[model samples]
Target: MPSSAAWLMALLLNLMLAISTVFIGSCLSESPSKVRLVGGAHRCEGRVEVERNGQWGTVCDDGWDLNDVAVVCRELSCGAAIKARSGSSYKPPAPQEQKVLIRDFNCRGMEDTLSQCEQDGHVYNCPHTKDAGAQCEKSPSKVQLVGGAHRCEGRVEVERNGQWGTVCDDGWDLNDVAVVCRELSCGAAIKARSGTSYKPPAPEEQKVLIRDFNCKGMEDTLSQCEQDGHVYNCQHTEDAGAQCENPDIDSPFIPENVRLVDGPGRCQGRVEVLHQLEWSSVCKAGWNLQASKVACRQLGCGRALLTHACCNKTTQGKGPIWASQMSCAGQEANLRDCPFRSLEKNCTHDEDAWVECEDPFELKLVGGDNPCSGRLEVLHQGTWGSVCDDGWGEKEDQVVCKQLGCGKPLVPSSKARKSYGPGAGRVWLDDVVCSGEEQSLESCRHRFWGYHDCTHKEDVAVICSESIPRL
Candidate 1:
């Protein structure tokens, strides 16, 4: 019923539509067969299969989003997401097989591969499939720290595909050695020689898989860079390895610098000299108050105003060096603190030591008749000094008593009248100042001196308020 011209035009339009549909279908069918993942799992950038007709093809990653890349990076452990590109680095997989066409791709630049991205399908017009081709890129091997024969040096072993291995020493260089050093935080690399200095490799272990590793000498780990084929012929004796050294330890204080003086216990205010990189006992000579005060000041104990000299017989036994008797002016805190007019002579090893202290509070005695009553004194220079009973108040007494934690202070004295047994070495009381508010005797002073006041008869002693408690 239509005119001839109208009929002809309709036929042409139908033909054109058919041709267009065919062309579109052909374009859609050109997906890739094989695809490549680049930038590791952190930054996936590549194309995926969309169609396959024997020859593989790729699709554009137009639909990829950040969430998709996040999933990919998380699975790879390559780091955070960076960037995701929809392009082909290698031939895409066959379309007939299950394919990833970039359904949902989200990258934060941390992913190592595109597969890590959360993608769904391929984007048409993708040009990546044309670049389909893959090469076996070498990965770095893991190195661990271990204890070696001398100090803390040890050998390194490589791991791959869950299998442990070693590297042949064929072309070991400073660059390679540097990687090992940086990885272990050890010192600089000393050498990179071939030849076995280490024990033989264990049996059943795979040979080192890397032969030619081109390092820049600054990489922290060998695994961070790329390498060549697996290396063999590197036995325990010929394989590459490294060694490292330990750091130095510090020690500034010792015993040779001390000298004992007169106090209470076998160990009391003592004067020791820090000399020859060691502490040595001094002979008691011109030990006096002045000298004692000087010594106390040197020891940062305020001032040395007291002096005590008891023949070595008083102390338990003469230490390293011994001298009998000590004389000093009240001007110095320790014998060492005094300027000697002439070294004392006729002094026996027993009387060699003396003590000096600035304030008598540096020393204290614990345990005795009363809680506040005990034998204790500090050494200034080489002279021994006693604490004043001033304010021999309960508060002060509490400190002494509680320090010994024996009994309460029944009597407090200002002068050295207790006439306890002969004392021992010099004692050093860091800092002692009783505000009377201290809860316990010990709490009043920083720490007690080495010596105390106690005669052979009473022998200053303490009785705990309670019986010995379990630890």
Candidate 2:
């Protein structure tokens, strides 16, 4: 054995060597490390690992927080903090040798990298080796509708987070469809459809994934839906859509006793029968003698009349009354009997000049089988709709009698019971109080007109005679 002093010195040396080794190992294991960002826009991710004795080692992410995410964002030059998660992809076999826990980190919320974040220590109790990962992304501020026809049969696209995407038609109901119609201001929702009617064929990538869609009944835009948590399986054919209709209007009746005038030259005049309103032009189309004769007779003019080709001057070279040519068979009754074009033209010399007619004596309808033969037929609505005889009581008939300058009501049938045909769509006339002050039949109050379910035979008719004389 060596002397006590020498033995003591040797022991001390060994002890110092062991301590130095530990210090070196610790320094080697806890050096600064680098991490790389992965993933892409709106969602970002990254991993970090330290170099120990030329070997890469990962730190546990237990200590990662908003501050650390901020540092990562600053380092990467990403705008701001979004989110962070902790867990391990790798775990050590030895319990004590597990990755160090990232207990605490402090950073300015706007920082870009973990390296810039202030940390409590290198050693951590992070549960797994792959625990430190994060995601940072930009957010969208606005949403809007993009393309397609906004009418009844069109597709609607949306823009969000700086990108455009189609809306999934899944779970689309009336409430949702209603909103879309309202947005376009296209009346009400007539139909709601799924399984795309207007999608592009063969798309390279998927378009949209709508999870939950809640729409207010009147919203016209699909983006107005409040989406829930569901991955929308919007395939090309699964895009949603809708259809709409136009609303009904109040005044849609035509006038009576309208006639066309065959002027002195080819540029003759034509007129339309509107409500006691006034006479307007039929404009001009292909004008032939037969059609002119029909128009003249319909206006109570006796026979075939002359024909005129009204030119640019009459149409003023504008509007729907552009150029027109008409053809008619004498058998037809009205000016509309002719088929014509809707453009304007210059009068040609070959075309006959104006047409004239001999007015027929006013003939009233009698209670016999030929009731409608000599009486005028008035049109209501777009079609030849009807009016009810609701107000045709004695007082009403008395007024009609005086207006026609004839006798009293020989027979007043309220429901068209005596004759035959479909009843009017709906009886619009009720309690019609006609006074002798009114001039024409149209000047009566209860003459409201609308769609009627009447056939030709049931049309309202009147009969008048000079006196109780002959029959």
Once fitted onto the true fold, the runs of candidate 2 whose alpha carbons sit more than 4 angstroms away are 1-286, 293-322, 327-391, 394-399, 407-471
C-alpha local distance difference test of each model:
0.44, 0.45
Candidate 1 CA-lDDT value? 0.44
RMSD of each: 30.7, 32.1
Tens-place lDDT per residue, model 2, 159-201, is 4543334566667777876765554334567676653564332
How does each model score on TM-score?
0.24, 0.24
Worst 10 residues of 2 by lDDT: 246-255
Least accurate 10 contiguous residues by lDDT in model 1 = 247-256
Model 1 over residues 80-169: C-alpha lDDT tens digits?
445444344422222232233443345454544444333435444444343222222123345643223322234455666544455666
